[model samples]
Target: MIKTKRLLLRRVRKEDWKAIQRIWKDETVSPYAQYDNIKELDDLSVTNRIARWGREAEYYNHIFFAVCLQDEIIGYISCNRCVDAYEIGYCFHSKYHGQGYAKESVLGVIAYLLIKIQMEKIFILMVEYLNYSLDGRGKCMKIEHVAMYVNDMEKARDFFVKYLDGKSNDGYHNVKTDFRSYFISFDDGARLEIMNKPDMADDEKALNRTGLIHIAFSVGSKERVDELTHSLSADGFEVVSGPRTTGDGYYESCIIAIEGNQIEITI
Candidate 1:
């Protein structure tokens, strides 16, 4: 069992099915549940489902837990094996909303997964309409720039400026170590910093390696993606993939940059 100052999280028991059904029946909580417009389950159905959840011994497949406070069940959280990653979902009674109980219970479950079960790479599926106020500090924050090193800075700068319409600043030159850089700003505030060691002994492009696989840019629509892909192909840039819907629901096309780096243009 995982205990916080005001909450306790433990394995869901058969007796807790009534509280679980109550939470699922709540209209407010039902909408945010794993399944949309989920129908309310009866005592027997809930019991069967609870039995199907199995135990920590069968955690290789799935697991579910009840979130409680003062011996009263308030909500439930679950983690299911999704291919290679664990996908987690949580639902709380509407009356308990805005109390940070969900966060505490999730953290406790994560601790159990990592420390006891020794599981890694948990994926939290979020609602599409929700925006995360990540730090809870009421401060606006965003990605300023993504930086990378290239063999040919001028060629890379020209490719982005000419094709991607990225505005370039006066290139920066450092004499101490002969490092050089250029900042390419897009229509949005986001910028890309391309840098290189001008006087380095070894200058070879690293492709199909471990770090920094690709950089993706979101376009206006699918039409824009097609247009950009055609333009890049016509300009002799390698179009690796098509302007098609990806398995992850992205309408995108992949192209190789001047320095052999993969760039994804998506809608």
Candidate 2:
């Protein structure tokens, strides 16, 4: 059982359904929560699915948690085991509007994962259609940029610096090259490099899929891997599969999310 000053998080018990239904029924909650407006609010189907889903998660170490205010249930948070990391999801009740509850709740869960469970990496699967014009930006989760391949070096260089890199017409690379390149980096040290070279094509294959495929988290080692797996389960992160070793000599796992992205855990 996890408790905030005004909220409690635990596995959904039989009695939680009533509060769950009530929370979902709030008119102010449905838009952001993505409920159907025309339908009479009934989460019997959802609760039923979640209950079974939680059970199935045990085999893979996946877990689910419900947020309650004293006895009134408000929302839920979920984390799933993926190839060496935790993937997160959250939602809340409509009645608790205008409070920083959602942000608080998410941060709380993440802190629990990083500090308590000792998870090194976390992935949040964001799909385009599933996006909410959130804050008017791309809402791509603090992404610096998504760079694709380009051809024709000299011409592309001028175009890139002129438009993307915020550069002027006069620019020169440290070394002259006929190949084109793109760089995407996070505020943190995370970075991705793409260059138009024959050998580089294979390297890009790891990340550049035409469609949304998978998001992964990197962990320290196999021991840390199992520790995180068990720790996340204790905190209610669902594990879909593994602590299994992949062909590359790394241990990995997976979990599913609402917007249809796979959370891959690997070391």
Candidate 3:
């Protein structure tokens, strides 16, 4: 249970389903539902959903909480761990809107996650597909994908595919813009978006360039780092840095690709 100055956040109970249903049925709150249009749900449908939420204690290994004030349920909060961060969402009864209850309830839940649950970082994707900006959320940044221009899309694709074990998408092409690209996805949901134009020149990136310096891939172990360094070097890839501990205590090695792009393989 999470308690604030004016709110109590707790697990939803069978009895709270009625209030939850009312909150979901509100047009104001229903707009925030990502998976379904809860405004159209009848009492039976709401009851079943609430029952499912109650039965699924972990909520698919995440969490859902009820926000209460003065012993009356007023809102709900749910979170899911996506990739390297957590996505959080909250909704309240129309009557409770603009009372700071939503923010307070969200803060309480965040505290529970960071302090009690010991999460390293928390990120908020949203409750709905529509975008709504938050004030001073401090978690506005989450890298969706890293994009780069590659001189040789095929070689760049092959490098990531062979070394990082990346899975290639079907790739994209735009004849009008003369743009071609490929998306390489890693196991941990990180993606590299490499694009190219036919007339683009192959230039060596200098160390002092004022842009993205390098991209890093985590291999999970020092042994794997050494092995990959040797194997990549043998395959004629440029080995820039060491398979030794760095100043920041990372067991890593840096390699230069055929496109002259730097990549750091780390543990």
Per-residue alpha-carbon lDDT of candidate 2 for residues 163-246, written as tens digits (9 for 90 to 100): 222222232244555454645332123433334643443233323357756546554345546766676556455677788987
What lDDT would each prediction earn against the true structure? 0.75, 0.55, 0.75
TM-score of each: 0.47, 0.43, 0.49
Pairs of residues at least 3 apart in sequence or in different chains that clash in candidate 3: none
Writing each residue's lDDT as its tens digit, candidate 1 over 61-180 gives: 456788898978899888865444577988888788788998888988888778877887799876632335334664334576899888899999998888776779999999998899
Considering summed lDDT, which 10 consecutive residues are worst modelled in model 2? 163-172
Better candidate number, 2 or 3, judged by lDDT = 3
The TM-score measured for candidate 1 stands at: 0.47
Clashes of each: 0, 13, 0
- Which candidate tops TM-score? 3
